[model samples]
Target chain A: MSQGNMNLTLKVWKQKNKNEKGRFETFDAKGISPDMSFLEMFDVVNEHLISSGKEPIAFDHDCREGICGMCSMYINGRPHGPKQGVTTCQLHMRSFKDGDTIVVEPWRSAAFPVIKDLAVDRSSFDRIMASGGFVSINTGNAKDANNILIPKYDADDAFNAAACIGCGACVAACKNSSAMLFVSAKVSQLALLPQGKIEKRDRVLNMVKQMDEEGFGNCTNTGACEAECPKSISLENIARMNREYLKASLT
Target chain B: MSEKSFFLSSSIGKKISMGLTGLFLISFLIVHVSVNSCIFINDGGITFNAAAHFMATNPLIRLIEIGLFAGLILHIIFALLLTLENKKARPIGYEKINGSANSNWYSRSMGILGSLLLIFLVVHLAHFWIDTKIAVFTGKADKHNTFNEMKEVFSNWYIVALYLIGVGSLLFHILHGFQSAFQTLGLNHKKYTPIIKKIGLWFSIIVCLLFASMPVAIFTELIK
Candidate 1:
């Protein structure tokens, strides 16, 4: 749908740091090429701001491709603009009209305090990952991958769970700011594999405990996380983690 | 934190309680609908009265009655707490929001439906339970003639309409709650979830319809 250039208005959030109050600053993004990526469009606007001797808006982004879950922005209320299954980086200007005014904001959650205009400190995810999101295997010898002989279905399910890129979109999209989808993805990715089975008990238990400590909300099964996920991760991972957690708690 | 306290305090832990209590309440609905359906025997409420009499008199069921109340109370308390916390989580809301693209209306409106059900429960208990239980124990009401009380209650068209509205709310609540309870408990399987969802829909419809029909039938004089 990329076509000719278009003029548009943009309302971007601006904050000096976590402590400072933020506000949306409007700008005229004139002659924006429809073919340009959303990030590129942002770059154009930032360059214009720089040339005009104004403080450019700060937003987090890396590896303009969608794979790196680094780029996070709430555009017009959705986690990553109007599209589904696409990160903010992959979002194209084609999704907008000639004069559309796009509203951009950072992920809002108690656990993810805002660091800048559109960047939130997502280290809570790293804390959850450290709390049993790993398996211990010796470095001395390498085992055959086929020796584990996981079923194709189980392997596929594990791969799906592992597809989560640790994006805070799930938290941002959830009405309660729940991190269940993110935590569940991590738990299920390990729980589905034999190599990860050894630490399954402590893993689910520890991760859940850490998740709670981070002040994330509970999963009410609203299914918003699964819907807004760029990777289209299934809600099944949450259920799987729940099963793993229940077993771990009982044992 | 202690394991028990953690389970009680944590979001997921409270969710588990919601599931467990919700499932317990579902069982109560099954028993209630079954007992109430006895009025369909078309024998002037003979079977219905006998079942109600037995339920009120049997010490075993009486003990279970207390447990049922506890389950209901716990369910209500946890639900209210969770809803409040969920609301607090999103203190600042979007101006141009679109939630319909993501989740079902019923899933999102559970708090409102639950509140309606809560109101319905209070009214229902006042209408039948309080009067019947007080009279039965005080030897002022015949335990075997509770069907007459049912008739008297349904005689008012407003009460019947209120009951129908309550059952309507219940239908929507259970349609989401049944599968959600199991999902929260981690009983979900790729193969079984669809089946469970289907069963949940049918179960809610049948149970709520049966409950609604009692009031309608009594008001219409179809059962008389």
Candidate 2:
């Protein structure tokens, strides 16, 4: 009820299943509270839908904390609406003014098929990660974190790269559909860590190989992924990934 | 899932093909720039014209041209297909982006800049290559050397202006393309990555500017 001062229209994508034809259906959102989170606003709309005996729009969401990255709606032409570094769940109704039109839809990628109205199958990302994401650390003994003693610079870089949430927003924002940012982040994360250094060459080669195999486009270096990423992951990671791959190839 | 199976897929194959072909095009620009520098020699116009003529008529060069064209076609096709796929992959834009200082502006505008370069290439080929090659083969052009045709075309102000703009855009393209192509090839590293990127930028700028100067000199009557 915090957004009660504003009136808005919601143009949301609706689909019964993956094979179902989807369309944007509009709904009136009046007396919305300004303090309501985007998801909370959705709850209000769904309440209205349920009361009217309408099938509520199904969207992927979990943790609502932005770390889980389960919220994958593209709002108003941006991955997480216009707010930078905020996930859809973290976005508040105050981000918009009254009488604004909000367009919500799921991620669109061949690799990510729509499961329903606003939910998509992001399993391709899992497959990409499974390709070569983790280092082969022996699980029998728990080593102290201090034992690694990686350079400060390397640790920072690795941490930055690891910040990627496996959100497919970068792939969507890219004009060439390049996943260089995502793949590079994964490659760089492991490549920077000492544990990851052992299989650095193989890891980068395999992940890049998997990325290409997934039918993602070549990295045209458009930097859109970096721009659109909720984590604000740098393109430098992609550059770093490139450097690792080249070294791997030569070795 | 397996490495063997992964590399064989058309997507991977196409990306590899694009990376290699793009690298080849970069190399061609270097060679083309070197040849174009002959305009500065002032050897009674003999040296430059001879080089130009050889490029136009040499069998080996023709073979290379075929490869170049193939690379160009594949690169464009793959680029288009990839864009369409990416469009499908992320129908929605992200809500918040964190890192912006990590990449150069040129790196972000590669697609738009590349399309511009492609348009420029078509115009360039039509004006220079098609005009001369087709005219020569079909007996429409007089028996003047290819360099003379170039000179005549370059003498026009509009042609000079167009060539300059094309070359400027190409310079921008190469600046980003050189670093990007390497990244696509998975060449990121801490020790030597920055060095390679700097080299890529300088190479692109110098080569593109060198080629661009030829038309400028001709238009200014400095070559005559």
Can you give the DockQ of every candidate in the order shown?
0.49, 0.28
**lDDT winner among the candidates?**
1
Report the CA-based lDDT of candidate 2 relative to the real structure. 0.75
Model 2: per-residue Cα lDDT over B25-102, one tens digit each: 888887788877887886646787677767777789989999989888887887777556655544544333322433
- Number of the top candidate by DockQ? 1
Q: Write the per-residue lDDT of candidate 1 for residues A204-228, one digit (tens) a residue.
A: 8888888888878778898989999
Residues B1-224, candidate 1, lDDT per residue (tens digit)? 22322567767778999999999999999989999999999798889888887887788999999999999999989987887776666555554556787888888788889899999999999988887688778976454477888898999999999999899999999899999988888887878999999999999999998999999999999988
Alpha-carbon TM-score of each model against the true structure: 0.93, 0.76
- For candidate 1, the per-residue lDDT at A203 reads 82
Binned by DockQ into CAPRI classes (incorrect, acceptable, medium, high), candidate 2 is: acceptable
The digit string of per-residue lDDT tens for model 2 on A83-196 reads 877788889999999999888877766667889998988787787788885567788788887986889988998898888888777766665456778887888888788888
* lDDT for A68 (candidate 2): 86
Candidate 2, fnat value?
0.34
